[model samples]
Target: MDPALLKAREAFKKKAFATPVIEAKRPVTSNQESGKESNKKPRKSAPAPVAEKTFDFKKYKPSSNANFACLAKIVKYMKQRYLDGDNEPLTLEDMLDETNQLDLAPRQRQWLATEALKNNPKVDITEDGQKYFYKPTFPLKDKKSLLRLLDKYDQRGQGGIPLEDIQESLPNADRCIKALGEAIIMLTRPTDKKKILYYNDRSIQFKVDDEFQKFWRTAAVDGLDDAKIEEYLEKHGITSMKDVGGKNSTPMQKRKKPTSKKPRNFKKHNEHMGDILQDYNG
Candidate 1:
């Protein structure tokens, strides 16, 4: 470096840049100024947000609500069939008789019939003109439930109460029966057979299988329920729930829920790792 240039640079840096000062009329000591500042009221910070107390009012278990809606509609159709006559079920052509005003398309009718048959065994689908379903309405829902109800209200000699009265009381009768894959046997039939009548003498009954009842009773259980469910699995030749596929299914891969109060991943690291700063490239 040139001595003159270095000297000039140092001199320029050391040069004082001064401006005229205008002081306040009353000047106080550092302590007095600080004291005065301290005396002034401190600013109030924003109030902390009040957390809302959340309440869970939901009672129903998680289910396919859309499927339930469709089921309800199908149930309504079944009830209508029962009301019409406990004789021959409606034909494909006769399906839209009541709702003919809705002007349903062919595809729509097919879809509805398909859904109705899926959950309902009582619904019989056969092709005539178009592929149509025969949904016969039953007097009650599940065979066991119907049997119990009948036993409760049976008049012995007079058989059961009027069939119309039972039909009126049981709105979801046919749907329940269909869902359970059970049948209702007409205990009393007109001697004429061809003649349809809802006389007080008419009685109904169901044959609820023991195996089905046991299976249904233990349906809502984990695979770990070895006592009852294991027997069922063995009888049906089912090794795992994964083998049985349906709407309400048990997932094979069970993962633990992630929690907020833990260090994620592994915490421990290699002790002999070299200094990180030495390897810096980026």
Candidate 2:
């Protein structure tokens, strides 16, 4: 034990003593954390409300009465021109001038001229340069002659009259001819055969009656056999012959016939012969 103890003491003396070690120090807060907290993005603000634009239509309202009055005046002037035998077609400028002579206001004159051109085919506008001119479409002096010519064309059922002839007849012949065409189309349609036979937008359509319908069907079927006719009649519930004709009629009378009789058998000889034989045997 002494020897082992001495060896242990020697070994303990030769061993080096260890010093306590310290870890490298670091800051408590990280740059990344600081940056995240400091540089957080702000929320976006809501958009502002936009102002709405308003439109005013009152400034553009048109007067029906004024327009009609202007049109009437224009028609009167055109009628006069037609009577004067000025067959040259009138333009929008001519109409505006006429309206001015009538003492209409600037706006009123323009409105009237526009109305006249719109309602009458005898008025037209020409873009001669930067501005447009108004004039009659025919060679006639005025509206009355225009009306007469229109009536004549309508009665005659003619359309597309020559522009030169119209101009020669009325100064505003182009418009007149167009108006006449429109009038004829409106007044003489096929539907207006009753009360008024002619209108711009109507026509006369004749109604088909039962007889006509029957005729139509018969014509359509043409050359049908008895069986085919019977099938048609049965399918259509045409029970009686009169039903096919669409009316009732008298029953057909029976034809007279010659009378005939059966011939009688006159055979009494066999019975008499049997009686004679019986008597001979007895």
Candidate 3:
């Protein structure tokens, strides 16, 4: 044995005698040791309240169909006449004649007139003794401008001739100098209420109210005739006359038949058909 080997054996034997250590687990606590718990289960949240909606029954109700059939017929006739290039405004008499021909009742006729007039502002009613007449308020070409003028006048609240006011209201005095002068003359002179005066700008204002009546009376005294009225309207470039039923012609003429031909062509057609049938048979 060597001295180094003896020392190594002694060191191995001493290191083989090392000890092992273990730690103990702690005890669990009961409910009494911890805070007390409630027996009741937590309440579930209530569902959010739903909002109630409101509805209006009136909004769903059907509207009245008053005068619908008559209105339709009038509209159809007017449209046909319009498309045929008849630019003349339909008179009340013309409309009444058409209604009567269609066998519409008096009430229905009135309703039709109201409806037509509502659609066409150019249609107006005038009185001649016990009779009523319808005349065109605007020309076919100037309908839009005429409507605009009607709206403008209605908005301005100036129904009567506002000659001085209109002249003063003009934007350009230099450009409208001649028109202003003419308006002054018209204001001073008498003219029919049915006669309209159109400005260069296409705005229309009628001669109305007591002042206009006074003017007409004075013109009548001065022997003013239809030709003079026409000349005045021409000077102002007025394209249409409204409420001219009794004013346009004499009472007798207004009462006279609008058409010279017989009522429709019923007899002529029957005769023509008879001749054709005879020829065919022969």
Highest-scoring model, lDDT = 2
lDDT tens per residue, model 2, 110-227: 5644554555564554455222323544445654675666556656886434434445446554565465565543232346342221223324446779998888787655788766
Clashes of 1: 0
RMSD (CA, Å), each prediction = 38.3, 27.6, 28.1
Residues 151-232 of candidate 1: C-alpha lDDT, one tens digit per residue: 5544454354444445544545456434434323344445634321122223454678999999889868755554576577
Model 2 regions more than 4 Å off:
1-63, 76-85, 89-101, 112-122, 129-190, 194-282
lDDT of 3 by residue, 44-109 (tens): 999999989786543443223545654555555654454344534556566547665555445555
Model 1 worst lDDT run, 10 consecutive residues: 192-201
Report residue 262 deviation for candidate 3 (angstroms).
99
Output the number of the TM-score-best candidate.
2
The regions of model 1 sitting more than 4 angstroms off are 1-74, 84-86, 126-282
